[model samples]
Target: MLTLLHTADWHLGAQLQGWPREAEHRKALRALVALAAERRVDAVIVAGDIFDSLNPSAEAQKLLYDTLKELRAALPAATIVLLAGNHDPAGRIEAPRALFDLVNVAGVGTIARKDGEIDAGVHLLPLRGAGGAIEAHLLAAPYPRAADLPILDGASEGSPVVRSVRALYAELIAAARARIGAAPLVVTGHLHVAGGLESEGAERRILVGGEHAVPSDVFPEDIAYVALGHLHRPQSVGRECVRYSGSLFPLSKTEIDYNHGVTIVAIEGAATTIEHVPLPRPTPCLRIPPRGGLARENVEAALAALGLGPATPADDKPFVHLTVAADGPIVGLDAEIDAIAEKFPIRLASLTVERPPRRETEAPAPAALRLSERQPVELFREAFALTHKSEPTSEHMTLFHAAAAEE
Candidate 1:
């Protein structure tokens, strides 16, 4: 039985912007390694996006190296294949391929041309790098740039650009099939295959009828499975054999709905069975908007609704955004805001203070009273004061004071 653990979009060293979810990311990586070891699969395929940024910090690089080392050691017999995703710089990912090779780990990025037929009872063809000739049952197609394909001589039916790119991709797929001969194959790629899941900020919309859409039929009839990447959501492309493993971690809020995990394919002879092994729960975030009249109570109610209760130092807090209206007279408003800020692990993105419409019966309050009533502006002023206290530069203070005056 040839069992392979298919996982993609590790996105190691990714920061949740200002969100404090770094610990979850670290836990997920460690869990992945453990999963590989526990499954005892023949190989573990990391489809791409190993690093969050091309210019990763030293700590990020070390974390990745250590994870790779642990996986390799834990699964000594398994082949760990790492493919380069769009986020990863091709040259940088390929640089450490050889170093990992010394320890039974195989890395295939944009630059490495590791193509050939491996006859381990079953004919396994590994195709890496841009475009290459394959003569095996399985063909692995890496990230191919638009310019890498052969140019089309004549445009067929539709727009010139669209038709030409389509023809080129068709030719490329055909070439791959012809080279593989009659062996039952599995073609893998890092491109956006058709019929894949797309969440917000997960996939950039492909131009209508662009070359990005590689039809599901491109794979030869003999091919059993097509493992793909690039898209962060895990899904199949029409055919059962063709699938995307998706990213290992939730990169954005859009990915909250997606169950982060890897696909496990069990192949015995000609038949294949697929199963998804889910990852741990991700960090949660809550956004609350308090009602106008009861500002303090509303704030407390929002916190309670999130199950956060009164915040403590030890409690791991969710990223919280509070919105409230503060036109009514409220006691200790500043102190309440400060208390919430200090007590809970909350990030105040915006605090909008809505004012009630003018009433003929109600007399206008004094300017001092009006100033005290404006909570959002006061929040801004408080933020400014906190910021200025640390820096304490004349120019910064002037800017803060000007902003405070406007508030």
Candidate 2:
């Protein structure tokens, strides 16, 4: 049996933007490497989105490099293959392929239209490793442009751009299948195949008739297994032979519900069995709402009710949304709010204060008086006059006295 570990969407450079996720990501990576070692898979396939951005920070690069190195040391016998996802810049990712290749790490980012066959006791279709293949024909389909294909029948005429894209992908897939003639053929692609699950924060809507939605029938019928990337959700599309491994870590809050991990596949003869490996130490987040007004007392009470306090910091300074209703007129609410903020590592992403309705017994004050009531102009004038008492002049004193009187 040929055992393969399938994982994707590492998003190594991902940051929670002031939120703490570094530790969780590190934990997830360790779990993945451990899974690979424990399973002793013959090979490992990473679908795509290995890095969150093309130009990741130095810290991110260091983390990825260290993790990959550890994985290599742990699984010296297994072949590790990494495909390029849309989030990664092809050119930049390709630069490191050669260096990794020196250590039995096969990087597919640099190879454009390459095919390879492997012999792991089981006769594989592609013979040549990496870029060049020694099979009847091995086709490697990268992300294809949807605007280069022929138009569909119902597609509006004169929409050559749209039609060509559809036609191009069809031709690409058709051309790929034409070359495979049994012999346990396998194709690896990074495009979104039809009938795959999409995670939150994925590219908005795959093109209506674009390359993202290639029909499952496009793959060769004899193809042993199709390794797919791009989509972050693990799923079997059309046939059991085709599958996505999903992402290795949750990239956003939307993915928190998803079980971040890798898929283990055992390929014996033509049959394949897949098992999902769970990630370790998933990040936990809580969203708390204020029960009453945002007055200092109420805010403290709400915090206590939610079981949150300055003494007990959250596992991660939880993302908090604070809503308060103030009972009476308050002063320096900003400073009081800041004091509350200092208590926990929690960041107030949003703070809302709702004022109670005016009482019928309360008479409406004049606009001037109301403005003065909130911000006393007299206090500012007095402070200014005291500060410049040394330079007092008739004109200055007159201006200061007038300002004080108006207040």
Candidate 3:
């Protein structure tokens, strides 16, 4: 039997609305280490996006190293696999290979090739269990960059990028099949697969040659389990075995409702089962009124109803996103909210106003304009109107023109 703990999209060093997430990350990682120790899994897989940015701060790097050390100490007989995502610096993650080897850690950043052929030795990893016997085989494929994929000459069956991606996996699966006669095969991916739900305003749109999503058929049907990343929502795509572990916590307002956690996979013979292990959120995300926008007149009462006191520690305060109903632009709205917010213990992250419906006599919106047919000024006006429910003022147009000219 082979047991594995799957997690992804840690996004260490990430900040939500200018608020640091180090405290939340630290608490969640500590809990993860404890969970692994308690579960005694044979392997740990971090799919991708370990850091929020390619260039992380020194503290973020320290946090990563410390967490790895803790995992090593907790799971001495297990294999640790870390793959790079689009947000990571591939070479940077693999630079400390020598140091990682000392603690039974495998870091796969990019697909390696030797003499114009895929190098299986670097991408194929062995999962050693009790007495150092190979119990399972793991294909550690990181985010496939444009250069990493094979050059498919005259391949017209599908998108070139998708075909190349599938080709790369097919080669790895073949290599893995030869070594593992009956052992289970696990694969990892850091790309967006079709049908997977994404968190708006949080996940970056990844595209190669205008292709953003790949079909779930990219993975073979016989594979034991596919660990995917890059989507904040934990879900199964195409098959029950193919799943995304999701981010450690809410990274933005759009992700506040996500059940952030890790996945536990147990493989015994031909029977495979998985379980979700949700981690604790040190700081909770709260929305005012909890459903829709609150009327502006009731805003003060809603703020007071949260029951938070001024003595609450800053670290323990919940993140609040306020939605207020507005007829139109209200003067001194920001100032009024700021004064009321000072009395509460929550951290204000964002604010939105729901405008009244447009009149029936108003003309319907025009058909969408293509990039080639749309002017910068016209596009700017449309965007502003969509958000504010009114046309942009002359000052707003002037500012937009100035910005466009500078660009």
Per-residue alpha-carbon lDDT of model 2 for 298-355, expressed as tens digits? 6665555655556554544555556666554444776787687766566554565666
Q: What is the lDDT of candidate 2?
A: 0.60
Ranking by lDDT: 3, 1, 2
Ranking by TM-score: 3, 1, 2
RMSD (CA, Å), each prediction: 10.1, 10.8, 5.1
What is candidate 1's lDDT per residue for 321-400, written digit by digit as tens?
45565554433665776576665555443344455566778545434546557775455545554433223447655776
Compute the lDDT of residue 397 as modeled in candidate 3.
Answer: 78
The per-residue C-alpha lDDT of model 1 at residue 367 equals 47
**Model 2 Cα shift for residue 330 (angstroms):** 16
Residue 110 of model 3 has an lDDT of 94
Error of 2 at 263 (Å): 0.8
Best by lDDT: 3
| Candidate 2 Cα outliers beyond 4 Å, as residue runs | 18-20, 110-141, 145-181, 204-211, 287-342, 347-407
What would you estimate as the lDDT of candidate 1?
Answer: 0.61
